[model samples]
Target chain A: MSLLKEFKVLAFLVVLVTGAVLVYAIGDFPDWGDPISPASEHVSSYYIENAIHDTAVPNIVTALLADYRGFDTMFETVVVFVAGIAVLFMLRRPKRESEVSMDVSGSPIVKTATRIMVPMMQLFALYIVAHGHHSPGGGFQGGVILGASLILMAIAFGLPSALKKISNKATVMLSALGVLIFSGIGILCMFLGGNFLDYSVLSAILPGTDRVMARSHAMLGVEIGVALTVMTAMFSIYADLASEGQLDQGL
Target chain B: MIWQFDIIILTLVIVSALSALRIRDLLGSAIIFGVYSFLMCLLWAGMGAVDVAFTEATVGAGISTVLILATVLHTKRRTKD
Candidate 1:
């Protein structure tokens, strides 16, 4: 007991010293919205000034994420896919004969309310994904919202009900499909004689569009791919966690 | 950001973070952590990063909270440490 007490005191002192050092270091940081700061003076300025001219996307964040740094976002989607697979491997158990389904359904009122809200939620998620080029949201956020709607269904009804809509096998397939969609677009760009993920070259295939519009359209396609992967992965993680990977009833 | 709103939200964020850490009940701790996440989202929105704020609200406050609650269902409600 005395040894444990001493360790706690030592930990607290270490934390204090670290905090003080970090606080002191913060003083050297540039002020908020400093135009001349290293971060804002370099690539940020380029993205801010030319994103619209290059990608025809009003939102610089979207252009930066889905166009300028598209390869990173594609790998990020793969990471989410891998994470879902890892959770499945770690926690998923084979269905057992002795397993029992738990009643997580709240009440009729809860069910009815969820039924009403789910459509609205799904619509809003779609809007977020579609409007991401002009607005604040994009694939990751929209996908999470979509996944949350499924989770809401699980909570109101039961895990079994939600599983019926998107089974375990479907989750894996859908997640993989998402990555495929993103990479497929990049491959198409390659086939069209452009560098991978270079959307401007896609204008050759997409009729009635110039280079800039083609980039914007290609970004939308990429965003959809990212959204698909993120939403399915999120739901798969929640389902595995809730059911202990049984895919049965969940709380 | 307005200084007053920033100060209040920052204080609440710190309080919620400390309480989430110090609470003995795992469920309460998870909920407090969600509150802290929501406050952080608000702070981000106030700082004019609406996109980041949106992500924080959805992933940090909403989905992560539900995920934690689901995990808590399988474990003991109280912490030993």
Candidate 2:
């Protein structure tokens, strides 16, 4: 047998053995529906119990994500921002004549469909971002949808057309603005005599708002920031990757 | 975790993942990967992780597939091997 075939055979055997071992190991895990599973018995119960009271948000996931774990989400947003900048820095190059594509825009039907649905898609994404406190969607998910709408625009109408709507400079600035909004909230909370990202103190800035209400409002702002960062970052990455740094004549 | 729904989606996810790995056409592989992502999204939602399922559907199925298709456009469609 050839070397490649031998390698594939060996890899297959290794995968089979690993799968068997993993399946066997599943026996050690807590029961599928057990309420007493270690995960549910600990910090999760605390979060579930206090989530609404603490953040005034009906969605426990959003409360935990943007309130109890705001610091972690802040850094995650920074990571995404950095990724966008990194892609731009690495992939951006001058377009060459030889690299010009056969043109993007798949067909007339696809283009017309995109033109019709892109607005609705973007509106839905915005709703997802804004309604995260009461719904299953959040910053990352909504931002991705928003970015995907832009990508769909790019794919259906060409990169240059999409770029006209959200140019490179605008993308970079918006990403930075998103990170700024996140950290700015944290710093303001600190200035108001609370711990970093302790949004309870935000009540001081907004008259007649209680701590819980303030926290909810702050969480919305934070989620919006995350959504902005993620949306711009994902779009930038797509632009660089699809255009191969030249940012023109892409599919 | 409803075993009924989970089991159905689980099989589809496995099938799509395997096919994605074995497919020769790069674009076909990307499409199969998107199918795998959608199946996994259903699995996640069935398991009561709606946010995760949404993320998987949007980022995994939607965005990742688009990027892969774009990459395939820029690169070779057929694998040499």
Candidate 3:
């Protein structure tokens, strides 16, 4: 172990040299707020200018993210789902070994605080998810908040209370459902004679709505699916890691 | 010339990060790192990148801190580093 101590200094020096090199190399890049930079002159301008017209979503980030580049977002959800599964596979104890003090809440005061705070957090998360078309938030941010609420419940009232509310089986199912909803929508669009995730073609299934309005509605649905997957993934990861796979005792 | 927010917040970030590095207790370092994350979130929000800031706030200050603290609780508290 002492031999490893000698390498710490070498590691620090390497990091310092790398930082200096990065600072020097950054001179080649354009300065902050440079108008003529490649990014500013590229597709971002098109996205900014045409996103609202094409998608009928006021939020450009939302439009570009959940609509124009929905395939990327769908895969990102899969990555989070994989992370949850990874934690479960790596640490979750066998069912027989998971029989410990699973229902012991932390303390009365903590429980009281969590009881009051959880609902508000959930409500706010819903607002963030629903209002994403007009605001800075979207599925990922809201889903994190929603998941945090469940994690808070676990911390305050023990893992059993949290798990009882939404069992591990449910989360596993839901994580898949979220990704399924996304890809399913894309597949449906394809079946309707449009490209994958081209929500404009979804008007056939929904009447009294034009193509733009259909796209707007479809974006919201995709965002909701994303939120569901993200929230469940976070919840599952927390449970698996905190309880060391037992799902019984956790902080 | 009112760089007051940036200067103060950046100073806080640097100070918190340094303290986190210096702290012998793993839990204390984790909490201080949370403070650093929060300050970095504020800096990102100030720069008008609200989405990035939101992610930083939720992931860095919120979930990662909690997860790391749980990891510390599972392991030893004190550190030679």
Number of the top lDDT candidate? 1
Off by over 4 Å in 2: A1-7, A97-103
DockQ of each: 0.91, 0.85, 0.72
Q: Itemize residue pairs with steric clashes in candidate 2.
A: none
What digit string (tens of lDDT, one per residue) describes model 1 on residues A1-251?
99999999999999999999999999999999999988898799899889999989999989999999999999999998899889989989888677566677879999999999999999999999999999999999999999999999999899999989888799889999999999999999999999999999999989999999999999999999999999999999999999888888879
Number of the candidate with higher TM-score, 2 or 3: 2
- Quick one: ranking by TM-score, best first? 1, 2, 3
Model 3 misplaced stretches (Cα beyond 4 Å): A1-7, A95-103
Task: Supply the DockQ value of model 1.
Answer: 0.91
lDDT string for model 2 (A1-251, tens) is 69989999999999999999999999999986688998899899888888888888999998988999999999999999999999899999977877546666779999999989999999999999999999999899989989989988998988888999999899999999999999999999999999999999999998899999999999989989999999999999999998888888556
Better of 1 and 2 by TM-score: 1
TM-score of 3: 0.94
Tens digits of per-residue lDDT, candidate 1, B1-81, equal 999999999999999999999999999999999999999999999989999999999999999999999999899999998
Pairs clashing within candidate 1: none
Per-candidate TM equals 0.98, 0.95, 0.94
